[model samples]
Target: MSVPVAPTPGSAPGAPPGAAAPGGGAPGAPPGARPPLLSRGRWDGVTTALRSPAVLALAPLTLIIAVFFLVPIFGMTTIAFAVQTDDGGTRIGLDNFLDLSSHSRAMRNSVLISVVGSLIAAVAGSITAFCIAQIKSERLDSVVAVFSSVLANDGGAPLAFSFIVTLGNTGIIFGLLGLEAIGFTLYSWQGLVAMYQYFLIPTMIMVTLPTFVGLRKEWTEANTSLGGSRLTFWRRVGIPIATPALLGGWILLFGSAFATYASAAVLIGSGGFPLIPLSIDSLLGSGLGAGGQSTAMALGVTMVVIAVVVLFFFNRLQRRSARWLQ
Candidate 1:
């Protein structure tokens, strides 16, 4: 007399309920012991996607940039080259680019402010960042860091407004120093440089503080043990290791000043400063509106290109600068 065998859960479906799966497990292997290859692959993929710290951290930023920054860059670049046909149909052409050359003075001024302001800011801010990095008191460091954060973002209207009050003719600082007697005004190129440094310094400081803090004391001690003076160590090891960070901060400041609109606009309102942002705003507002829209878009596209270039520089610098630090 024989009884029929039942296949176990791990067996082939067609096998007896309690019988072994001939191609796979034994007579009574646990159902959960090993999933099929396809199922395992899917689970592994899901777990990897979930557990990756880099993906988790960058996902939100990537989404935001894709939606906001990249989409707008495409739209703006399209508008820059768009031309209206006789029947009002739009097509891409070089008319806007030809006209963009007419904005040379504004371009020159924008670059001038950005370059000069960045240099001053990078130098001044690095000095301040070095000082901040050296403070042994965590509380004092926190307070200074808070102040730097406030100033770095204290751009636009508030900054311009404060400068106006202090640097304007009737304001307290101006009245006290009588800057007007020596012929000073906050509406000219020189004044704009000063005004731009207000934000640029803090921006540089914010970017540079980390580099200063990352400089290891052991390296300096090693340099000194090698018979290098403090000045020699700084001039050679310290500065060489830090050049990338400083240069990155400078480029950042330049981009900030170049794209700045509100502060410059407010400070030089109706003063005919040939800044790119002001020209764009004016073109959008004045009787030139219809004719200059494309040119304004062209300027915008230029700014986007510049910003992307700066970002590329920072990334490349980080990779290469690692060797110097090591």
Candidate 2:
């Protein structure tokens, strides 16, 4: 005779103790059966509800970028490729790029200026940051922090004017020092780099300060205990830890210097120096010649390419540094 199975626990009265409920006739079916796919107790529904609001909020940002940023970039790319007609229509071609090669000097000058200025700023800023972070006095640290904060926000036209007033011929500083008639001009490419550094140094210091704080003092002490000189410690330990942040800050500084227009424009005048951004402004406005516009766009493209390469190297450095730290 077959063994009788008891009804499953919690089943209706008179059902065998091990028998399944009305849903099925198997023993212990309730615990062993698959759970309901959309059970209210499951985490999937809760997670979906929690994430839905965030997804909804991001929709506006997505729409804004699509409409404003991507659309304009597409239009600029189109303009960079097409030849402009006298009647306002563009004859689509590669003439724009072809014209860029003719003004290679300006391109080279801008790249050289940005690279040199950024490297100088990075080195100066890193040293300043290292010094400030290593200091033991709270008051001095607060003062430096305030200075960095002020300079970081101080850019654009006002900064340009300030530099002009300080270094420009016939300005107060130059005039009082009798440098104006001595053939000193702070309105050249070198002058622009100097002005850029005023802001770049402070900005880089801010970027690098946090990295300095994150550095453990133990490394320096350990190196000293091992008879390593200060220079040796810095070369072997300090730089490796800080190199990623240093390089990243430099990349940002370079990008900032590359894109700056108003400062250079105010100091040097539009035609005197032809940095890419300055050139672009002139091309879009009074310098609306075909060659000017094409060359300006090409220079803009070049600046972006340089920025990309710098950022890529910086990120690789960061990853390597992080691994080393670990």
Error of 2 at 133 (Å): 2.1
Residue-level lDDT tens digits of model 2 in 1-326: 01111221223333333331323333333755643545533333333433444444545676677778777666677667778789998787777777766666667778887899899999999899888888856687677778887887666788878877887765788778887566667877677778889888998887777677656778889999999999998799888788887888888888778777777777766777667676667766757654676656665666667778877877776676566454
212 in model 1: Cα distance from truth in Å?
1.6
Per-candidate TM equals 0.74, 0.71
RMSD each, Å: 11.8, 12.8
Off by over 4 Å in 2: 1-55, 82-94, 137-150, 176-183, 286-296, 322-326
Q: Which segments of candidate 1 are over 4 A away from where they belong?
A: 1-72, 84-91, 287-289, 319-326
Q: Residue 102 in model 2: shift from native, Å? A: 2.8
| Count of backbone collisions in candidate 2 | 10
Q: What C-alpha lDDT do the candidate models reach, one value each?
A: 0.75, 0.70
lDDT (Cα, 0-100) at 323 in candidate 1? 60
Query: lDDT of candidate 1 vs native?
Result: 0.75
Please write out the lDDT profile of model 1 over residues 20-135, one tens digit for every residue. 23233332435546435455432443334344454456567667777787777778789898987899899999788778788898889889888988899999999998988887
Candidate closest to the true structure, highest TM-score? 1
